[model samples]
Target: MADGTVKRQIAAKVRQAFAPLRLEVVDDSERHRGHSGYREGGESHFRLTVVSDVFSGKRRVERHRLVNSVLAEELAGPVHALNITALAPEEDSA
Candidate 1:
């Protein structure tokens, strides 16, 4: 996968896996320009904020693990850093 499409691919995979009510996948690659793991064309670093019922009753780490499991391939490949904020729908109201 090319750098430009990784975020879209991630959003699709997360939607498939968790069915999040709200999902935002932001590519922060530009912020790390010229740093290690920073690809010249961007899409190296990303931050995901996901709200879903699938996260209900799960611990924070577990939620992260859930996302990590889904994105294992991306993490192991072109993705450099993934900063995730996974939240249950209920928690979002808090």
Candidate 2:
């Protein structure tokens, strides 16, 4: 898939999987330009900030696991790195 398509797919998958109160997906690959694993082709690194009720009472590791599980196919294939910031709705500052 093209970079834009991949990004949209990631966003849509996250929204569908978590039903978050808030979700933001940022393309951070530009900052890593020329670095190892950096894709000159397009953005590959991402930062995902998500707040969801599903994260309530869940430990950090568990929350990461849940997100990873939801994006398993993408992670295993297209997405090279994901910087995930997960929070419960009540814990969200925004």
Candidate 3:
């Protein structure tokens, strides 16, 4: 996948799965240049913050698992790292 396409795919998949009230998908591959798993094009690393009711009663690990499951294909291929900040709407406000 190309740099921009990977990010868009991730955001779209997350949005479809969680229907988050707020979501941000940031490509951090540029910062990982020269590091292991870094690719010529950016899209290998990402930071994701998602707020939704689906995470309201879930544990942190569970929330991450949900996101990971949704992006399993990407993670297995082009994406090297995913830093997720999953939150409920109330937690986001806090």
Best by TM-score: 3
Clash number for candidate 1: 0
Evaluated against the true structure, the overall lDDT of model 1 is 0.91
User: Which pairs of residues clash in candidate 3, taking residues 3 or more apart in a chain or in different chains?
Assistant: none
| Residue 3 CA displacement from its true place in model 1, Å | 6.7
Report the lDDT tens digits of candidate 3 across residue range 1-94. 5539999999999999999999999999989999999998789999999999999999999999999999999999999999999999989963
* lDDT (Cα, 0-100) at 80 in candidate 2: 81
lDDT (C-alpha) at residue 53 in model 2? 94
Model with the higher lDDT, candidate 2 or 3: 3
Cα lDDT tens digits, model 1, 2-94, are 446998889999999999999999899889988899988778899999999999999999999999999999999989999999999988853
Error of 2 at 1 (Å): 6.2
Q: Point out the higher-scoring one by TM-score: 1 or 2.
A: 1
- In candidate 1, the residue pairs with backbone N, CA or C atoms under 3 Å apart (3 or more residues apart, or in different chains) clash, namely none
* Model 1: CA > 4 A from native: 1-3
Compared with the true structure, all predictions reach lDDT values of: 0.91, 0.85, 0.93
lDDT of residue 41 for candidate 1: 77
TM-score of each candidate structure, all chains considered together? 0.92, 0.91, 0.95
